[model samples]
Target: MNSQSPQTVLSGLRPTGRVHLGNYFGAVRNWVRLQEKYRCLYFVADWHALTSDYADPSKIRQATFDAVADWIAAGLDPKRSTIFLQSEVKEHAELHLLLSMITPIPWLERVPSFKDQQQELKDRDLNTFGFLGYPLLQTADVIIYRAHFVPVGEDQASHLELSREIVRRFNNFYGNVFPEPQPLFTETPKVPGLDGRKMSKSYGNTIPLTASADEIRALVMTMFTDPNRIRRQDPGNPDICNLFQFHKLFSDDATIARVDRECRTAQIGCVDDKKLLAEIMVENLRQIRARREEIDRDPSIVWDALREGNRIARQHASETLELVRKAMKIDFPELR
Candidate 1:
């Protein structure tokens, strides 16, 4: 296989079990489209998962598989993209350590997510070195591949900027070996949950991408609409309604226009609108749902694809590590 995918795009996802509609529309779908245009390396960031969920550590293995199955089900073809588990490629650890030695303590602390995550997961004991240094590890994750682009949402561009700074610092000290990765900015749709909040699994308000038709129907039926529209005759505000946002994603253009127009005129009720969305969601998800089930029946297919990706990624990682070793003056052949 060609190891050189010019202008390569590297990205990974921390295992979070099956993905919800928010995950699919906001990111995974963009990953699928990316495979068609660039040489993409997609990985399961299992090691990154430990940064927060180290207490239990039991769910990582299963959640990794669940996430990959959904990734394949959503359209991330193994043949088109290099898909592997991050831990399987050990070179990442070596490079991460090398970067950490030169990185300043203030650099890691200043990363926005550092304090933000600690506050969000306040219950967890996050004083460990792993949590503080995870951002540097992320720098390793991208630079190890010398990836040129990393697909990220608009809000996440700042997070990727730190990786660029670290890379520039490394190059200035050790000579330039890695490119400053650019953000492949993408359009992310804001999907709402059943209770009118942002759709999230933690919120217990997600509709999974692999949900069956019946399950989809039940979930959508409970979705919140315009709260002020109390009666069938009362005019509704589609802009404020949560289900209307979903309709924009799943429904046809004509239906969306009609719904918007009639919603304000009080011609269409919330129940009827939800019923329409449920059917549309079921239909839109039918192919992915079937693919996910087929992948579920034969888990080996997913693992086999991942194993091939592992082989490909390790080759690239080994080459990069050698360069890093030479650049850092750590490659002592006599010792070996």
Candidate 2:
């Protein structure tokens, strides 16, 4: 065994069904790489999913399974990193309830996403207790693992601050039971979908990470290009083209430079450019698709991995809960 003690990192994703390119470049890929360097814990935040979709949670179970499969297919090794469902741990809820007692109501209301999500998801009735306390639950998710770092993009840094504050308050009140987890800011590239908008499932423009080659081709072919360049011979600006943005991610430097020059010189048409991108994307997704297929052939593989992860996660969570209970003088003699 390696003698060096690895720093712990924790991160979770709400089981939102399909994993798309936006999710890959924005977070999941980073999680895969971080696992190689850190003691990582990744979970399907199924309870968090209820913050907004509590009305119809029939899909959460399937979404959790699919999301786990996507994470595995994207190179999150079950052996290297703890992978489990948040709800299965049980300790998270207990910690969340305990933390809620100390958390200020105004702090929950001030979280940026709380209002933003409410306005964005106007159709959903988010004026509920679960939605308000989502950040508190997230705080519990990080601190329960005593994670040293929580990998997040800039948009999520503020949310992590809430976790830090919660930790500070908890330690102040209950006698230093947890560490404040700092944000490990990661570079999350802007991934655009077919309509030249930020890639999102709600937009119906996503190219799912597990999509077949034909599906990839079909989606890529529909991606928006330089709208002003109406003719094949018309000069186009690669900087203004959504397809060019994707090329930057999937194509080599030489291919990108050539595309940039050709598009500007009216030497490459949007149709041909899209076709080239589709081919490269198909090649890129080939290995991931193959792995997903293998996992799909035996569904037990994912479940068994998650079950093992749940056990390991429970062990750590139980230890943390014991400390928490002891700190709060809630560990009754009978229970002990």
Instruction: Give the Cα error of residue 16 in candidate 1, in Å.
Output: 0.9
Clashing pairs in 2: none
TM-score of predicted structure 1 = 0.96
Model 2 C-alpha lDDT versus the unseen true structure: 0.92
TM-score winner among the candidates? 2
- Candidate 2, residue 297: CA error in Å? 0.5
lDDT of 2 by residue, 85-140 (tens): 99999999999999999999999999888888888899988889999999999999
Model 1 agreement with the true structure over 208-321: per-residue lDDT tens digits: 999999999999998888989999999999999988899889989999999999999999999998888899989999999999999999999789988999999999999999
**Which regions of candidate 2 deviate over 4 angstroms?**
1-3
Candidate 1 weakest ten by summed lDDT? 1-10
Report every candidate's CA lDDT: 0.91, 0.92
